[model samples]
Target: MSDRLVIENLQVSYGSGAQRVEAVAPMSLAVPAGQKLGIVGESGSGKSTLLKAVLGLIRPPGVVRADGIWLDGTDLRSLSRREFRARCGSEIAMIFQDPVNALNPAFSIRDQFRRSFRLHQPDLPRSRYTETMLRALASVSIDARDKLGRYPFEFSQGQLQRIMIALACSSPRLKVLLADEPTSSLDVTTQAQVLDLLHALQAELGFSLIIVTHNLPVVAELCDRALVMCRGEVVEDTDVISLFEQPTHDYTRHLLASMASLPRIASGAAS
Candidate 1:
C-alpha cells in the first residue's frame, strides 16, 4: 500500500560536535492514508523528535537528516520552508498534549477557529466562516454559541482539547493528524472521552494519525499498529494485537511490563 507519510533513515541531533545528543538514528516508518500508528516510548526516547522532524519544526542548532520523507510520493525534505508550509499547513495538523499551551490565551475560541478557516479558505465570506466554525464546534459536541466568544482560559481542559479538535477538523484538507500525548494532562475520564472523540473524528474524516505516547493500554485501545522506540532507534514495529500478544523486542516487553505494574486504577483517574 502507498503511504501518505514515510520517513526513511531519519537522524536528528541536538547541539554541536562532541556535546551533541543524537535523538534519532536511521529510523524509518510509514503511515498509509487512514491508519493509526502509535509511537510508544518513555521520555527521552526520541518519539517527539521524530514527529518534529516530519513537521519541519526543528529549530536551528538541531540537525536533521533523512534519506527522504515522502508525502504521497513528494519528497517533503526537498521543498523550501515556504513551499512546504503552503502544502503542509492544510494537509497536516497537529494536536499537542496540552491544548491550553497550544491555544492563544488572549484569543476567543472563535478567533482561533478563524485561523484554521483562513488557512483553508481565506476568501470565505464572514457569514460562511462563522457557519463553518459553528459546525466544526458542533461536530465535537461543543456548544457553539456558549463557547465561541470565550477565551481558552475560560474553558475546562477537556473543553479546550475538544476545541482544538474542532480547529483541526475545520480545515477540509487535513489528511493527517500528528498527536503528541494529547490526553496526558487530562483526568482519566476526560482522557478516555478525548481519545474516543479523536478516534471518531479520524474515522469520520478519513484522516490518518500518528500518536506518540508511552501509555501502552491507550495504544492497545486506539491504534491498529505500534512502533516501539528505545533510545534513538525503532526496535519493534508490528500490528497492535500481535505486539501485545507476542512482542519481539526486549524493550517492547519491558515497556508493557512497566505499564502492567502501574496502579490498577480505572481509566480517567489522575495518573
Candidate 2:
C-alpha cells in the first residue's frame, strides 16, 4: 500500500530560551494506507504531543516545527491555517481519550454530527445531513439515529466513544485516523468493544490507523508495527511480535515484564 501520511523532522516545544521545553524531539515516520501503527509510551513521553503537532493542534506559547508533513501527496505544512484545519476531519481525523471533554456539551448530537458532515463535505445537502448521520451512527451499531436530539451527556461513555469514532470516520475523504489513548478511560469490556470498532472501521474504510497509548495489549491486538517511546525518543521500532518476544530496549522489556494481562499476540485479535 502507498503511504497515506508521512512526517519528517517533526519537533515541538513550549516556552522560550532557557525555559523552553522540548515536548517532542525531531522524528520521522510514514504510515502506509490501511496500516495500523501503535505508539506506546508512558504519560508525558511526548507520543500525544507528536500526534497533535502533526495535526497542528498546538496553541500559542507552544511551537511546532516539521520539515514536512504530507498527507496523500499534499504537504500539510504548506496549507494556510484555515486550509489546514479544513484538511483535518475531511482527510485526517483524531479521536481523543475522553469523548466527554472532546465533544461540546452545549450542542445536541444532531448539531455536532451536522457540523461534522459539513466539515467533510462543505456542500453536502442540508437535507441529507440527518440521514448521513444516521448511517454513520448505524455503522458503529449505535441505535441513536432517532435520538440525535439528545446531548453528549445523555449517552454512556462507551456509546459516546462509539459516536466519536463514527464522527471521525464518517467522511469518505478520510485517509488517516489518529487515536490518542482512545480506550484508557473506558472499562475493560468497553475498551475491547471500542478497539474492535476501530479495527473493523479501519478495515471497512481503508484508512491508515495511528494509535498512541500506554496500553501494550491494545497495541498487540490492533497494530502491525509498534514504536516504543520514552523521554520523547523512540527506544524500539519493530513488528508487534518482536516487540513482545524480543524487546530491544530495557524500557520496553521492563514494560513487558510489568504487564499482568498479556493477550495472545500470535492470534492477532483484540480481546
Candidate 3:
C-alpha cells in the first residue's frame, strides 16, 4: 500500500545555542495507507513531540525542521498557514492526550461543535451544524436528543474521550488520524472502550491510524507496525511481533522489563 503520511529527516528542538534541547532527533518514517502504526516510548522520549511536529502544533521557542512532510501527495511544508490549516482539516486529524484539556469547560457541546464547523466548514448551513454533530455523536453510541447543550464537565472522562474521538474523525475527508496518548488518563475498562472504538472507526473509515503511546499492550493490540523511540531517536522500527519477541535494542528490552506486566497479546489487538 502507498504511504498516507510521510516524514523525512524531521527534527524538533527547543531553545538555541548551548541550551538547545533536541526533542526529536532527525529521522524518517511513513504511515502505510489504511494501516495502524504505533510509536512507543517512555516519557521524555520525544514520542509526543514527534506527533506535535507532524501536526504543526509546535511553536517557538520550539522549532520544527523537516526535509518533507507529505500528506497524500502534497508536502505540507510547502503550504502557507491558511493552506496548511485547510489541508489538515480535510486530510488529517489528531486526538490529543487529554480530552479534559481538549474540551472546554465554559462552552456548551453545541458551541464546541459550532466553532469546529465554522472553522472547517464555514459555508455549511448553520441549521445543519447540530444535525451533523449529532450524527457523529451517534457513531460513538452517544444518543443525544434536541441538542448538545450540556457542558464537558458533565460527562465522564470516558464519555468525553468518545466525544473527542467523534469530533476528531468527524471529517469524512480524513485520511490520517494521529492520536497522542489517547488512553493515558482513562481507567482500564475505559481504556479498552476507547481502543475498541478507535479500531472500529479504522475498520469503518479506512484511514491510516498513527498512535503515540507509552503502553506496549496498547500498541500490540492496535498497531500492525511499531516504532520504538528513546531520547528523541528511533531505536527500532519493525513489525509488532518482532518488537516484542526480539527487540533489537537494549532500550526496547528495558522498556519491556520496566512495565509492571509484559503484554499478553498473542497476536494483534482484540476485536
Best by lDDT: 2
Candidate 3 has a TM-score of 0.93
lDDT score, candidate 2:
0.87
* lDDT (10s digit) by residue, model 2, range 7-48: 999988889999988888888888899889999987788988
Order of models, best TM-score first: 2, 3, 1
Q: What digit string (tens of lDDT, one per residue) describes model 1 on residues 1-271?
A: 5688988989999998799988998877888999999889879989888888898889978899999998877888899876687667577878888999999998988888777666655666778877888888888888677668889888899999998888876778777889999888888778878888888888889888999986887787778999999888889999999899999999988888888988532353222
TM-score of 1: 0.93
- Give the winner by lDDT: 1 or 2: 2
- lDDT values for all models: 0.84, 0.87, 0.86
Error of 2 at 156 (Å): 0.9
The segments of candidate 3 whose C-alpha lies over 4 angstroms from its true place after superposition are: 260-269
Candidate 3 per-residue lDDT over residues 30-83, each given as its tens digit: 887998999998889898899889889998999999999999979999999888
Q: CA shift at 141, candidate 3, in angstroms?
A: 1.3
